[model samples]
Target: MRILSGMRPTGKLHIGHLVGALENWVRLQEEGNECFYFVADWHALTTHYDDVSRLKEYTRDLVRGFLACGIDPEKSVVFVQSGVKEHAELALLFSMIVSVSRLERIPTYKEIKKELNYKDLSTAGFLIYPVLQAADILIYKAEGVPVGEDQVYHIELTREIARRFNHLYAEVFPEPDAILSRVPKLPGTDGRKMSKSYGNIINLEISEIELERTILRMMTDPARVRRTDPGNPENCPVWRYHQAFDISEEESKWVWEGCTTAKIGCVDCKRLLLKNMKKKLIPIWENFSRIDEDPRYVDDVILEGTKRAREVARQTMEEVRKAMNLMF
Candidate 1:
């Protein structure tokens, strides 16, 4: 299947971000899917509008993270969204087709407004992001999108936009489907969503010691204050992570039973979790450090990706202009 997905290159990506999305993207590519993964720098502008000095830095780091995490550059078309000018032009055209009220009703827009508390800076860019995303996906005429559970609404809207466009103009675009990725729910140290703003994330760049320290401070069953106190793995946020990071099946079964029966202390559980986490990340961390040290090699890759992406985007825009009768 032809799949399109993007990650916002705004900050250091955390474990939650990886298990939630990127890992799945890599797996899909490995399974012989045509995947288009881009650094969604334009999407970052919706929130971080004033502070864009880090765009280049963040984009660079995100690309490094992708490579580090086994997102093979050969299997996937990784490009920068802003590098393709057609994304902007196509987004503008898509905005005309979609209604303002529809964008307002989106759950994500409301959530971001509350999260950022951006009473005044809730600009049109923030509201129309999903449309831009639709433009990004439809530009390639993606057969499907790899997205988190939160993004299903936006994809549903994208499907609607495709249907409307096909019915009104011509069937030039395919009605893209959402390939729901069942990603593990990785929580923060503070038991909130693992985000940079929350300041509770374990970034991929974190060292072995730092990773262990972060996991050690994790909150488990709040009621289980003592080692002897029986805990509920179902209620323990840290236990949720054990299911995610540890060896996935039988060996993990040992940790699960131990946690619920008070046979294992929180520290022991975290230690077990940390060992598994480190083992998984060591190679990825090595890959990132290699790219981090050599900036030129990564830059060359981005430039090549940008050039290839532009060619495809330009051809799609030609078809778009003709369909809209704007190809004069």
Candidate 2:
């Protein structure tokens, strides 16, 4: 099966990115599926158009993170979204098919505008990002897209665009389905959704000393004033980290019992989580360190992947042109 997914190149990835997307992507590639993972640089511009300075650096770092997390370039095609012109071409065609009213009606559109505190999000690019997303999926005819539930509406919109194109022109693209990741939302140290914009994220490239400090500083049950006070693990972010990192059912239960019975202090609980987390993180740090030193290795991967992706994209565009009678 051909699977398509991507992440925006806004900043260095964090633990939330690891648990939410990278882990699932690695699993899919290991399963022998044809995976196309790209750096969504164009998508980043939709919201971050004001800043172009860090875009290149972020794109490179994102690719490095993919390599560090075991997304093999041999098994998966990893490219930049804007590397091939077909994406924009198809996006332009799709923009004509999707109605502006429909784009405005998307739940996240208004939410994003408000979240960013934009007095007006009336930009043509911002509104039609979903169309570009649909083009990204359909251009490859991806059978599945790995995403969180927050992106279900975008996938639905992709399906709608595919349906409209096939009905109007030819059956050129498949309506991809959303392959939901079962991973829970990895919260920040502040117990909110881990995001760079929030300034609460623990970046993947953090030093061991920083990691220890970050975990120790993580939000716990505010109601628990003393080590003797019983706490609800459900309300604690440390408990959430344990759920994702600690694979041992017995140890997990131990954490629950210890926290609830006031048998262990929050410091002890964080130490346990830190131990398990380091066991996994040490290898990623090692890999990223090696990859970071070798810039040409990342460049080679992007170039090769772009070559492979363009071959498929060009063919799809040919068919699209033939169907729409655009070729003179």
Candidate 3:
């Protein structure tokens, strides 16, 4: 399958990013699928346009994170979104075909605006980002887009756009399907959705001491005010982490029994989780350290991937122009 997915270059990737997206991406590539993963730098501008200073730094950091998390450049095409000018061109073309009302109806549009009320998200770019996302998928003629549940709607929009384009012009793009991620969303230490804006993420680059402190401080069942009080693991955010971090069935049952019976305190539960999490994250951090030390290696990977992506994008644009009678 020709699979495509991307992440915004907003900030350093956290454990949420790993469990939610990167791990799934690595699995797809390893499964022998054709994957095109890019850093959505242009998409980042939709929200963070005010601060262009750290954009480059964030983009590089994102790429480094991808490399560190076992997203082998050899197996997948890894590029920055802005590196391909075709994305912008195709987006402009797609914008005309898509309706303003349709874009507004997207659930995330309203939700994100409410979430980021502090920022002025009234820009046209912010509203029509789904169109650009469609261009991102269709440009590569991706058959499947590996996305979380929240992003499934965007893929649906992409399919709508694809059908519209094909109906109006000629069949120049594939109506891509959403390959829903198997991993559930990972929450932050504060028990809210894991997000950079929330300031609750456990970044991949976090130190061991910081990781320990963060895990220990994670929110547990609000009802369990005292150590003696029995806790509900279902309500505890730490328990959610256990579910995500490959905790064994036996260990999970033990934790559940202990929590419900007040046999284990939140601190001990956190400590146990911390030990298990470190075993998985430490290797990824080691990989990140090695890649971070060599900036040129990361740059080369981006340059090569961008070139390859552009080759495919340019061909798609040619077919699109021919289909739309714009070749003249």
Candidate 4:
């Protein structure tokens, strides 16, 4: 099946990114699927339009990081979303078919605006961003979109757009389904959500020692006042990491028991987490460290992927124009 996935450029990736998506990308790329992965630079602008200075650097870093994490550009098509001007052009075309109310109904839109504390929700591009997302999927004729539950709403809108186009024009697109990833959980240093804005993220490039130090600061059961205090693992962030990373069922059970019995302090639990995280991230870091040295590699990869993506996009747009009679 054709799988479509992407990550926005954020300078360097982190454990949250891995647990959230990159690990899943690696698995799917290896699963013999035609994966179309792109750096969603445009989407980054939706949130960070004020900070355009780091975009190019972040874009390059994202490409390199994905390469380092075993997303072989050879096996999958990797490109930048804005490389082809057609994405924006098609986004405009799709905007006409979707309603403002529909865009408002996107659950994440309000959540993002409130979370980001934006000065205004007035950016036209920001509000209707899902239309651009639809154009991205439909352009690739993607059979499935590999995403987390958070993005299910966006893909649903994409399906609606595809359905609308088919009903208005011809049977030109497929209704893509959300291929939810069997993703692992990756938390931040503070044991909250791993986000760049939070400054609690363990970047993919940081040393193992740094990874350990970050884990050490993670929040635990507040009820556990002292090391001797028995705590509930259910409320500990460190325990959450164990649930995601600890492979041995016995080990996890031990964590639960130790925490519930106050045998292990949150510090020890965090130390254990850092050790396991290093085991997972060290190899990816090693593979991707030299990626930036290749000056032409990112450009070449984007050019090739864009070439193929544009071909598919052109085919779709041809039908769209013919159906809408743009050229007749």
Alpha-carbon TM-score of each model against the true structure:
0.96, 0.97, 0.97, 0.94
Off by over 4 Å in 4: 184-186
Q: Once superposed on the true structure, which residue ranges of model 1 sit more than 4 Å away at CA? A: none
Worst 10 residues of 2 by lDDT: 180-189
For residues 184-221, could you state the per-residue lDDT of candidate 4 as single tens digits? 45556566776777897767788777766667767788
User: Who wins the lDDT comparison?
Assistant: 3
What is the C-alpha lDDT profile of model 2 across 101-138, one tens digit per residue? 99999998988898888545678999999999999999
Better of 1 and 2 by lDDT: 2
Residue 73: error of model 1 in Å?
1.6
Order candidates by lDDT, high to low.
3, 2, 1, 4
Q: What is the C-alpha lDDT of each candidate?
A: 0.84, 0.90, 0.91, 0.82
Candidate closer to the true structure by lDDT (higher is better), 1 or 4? 1
Clashing pairs in 2: none
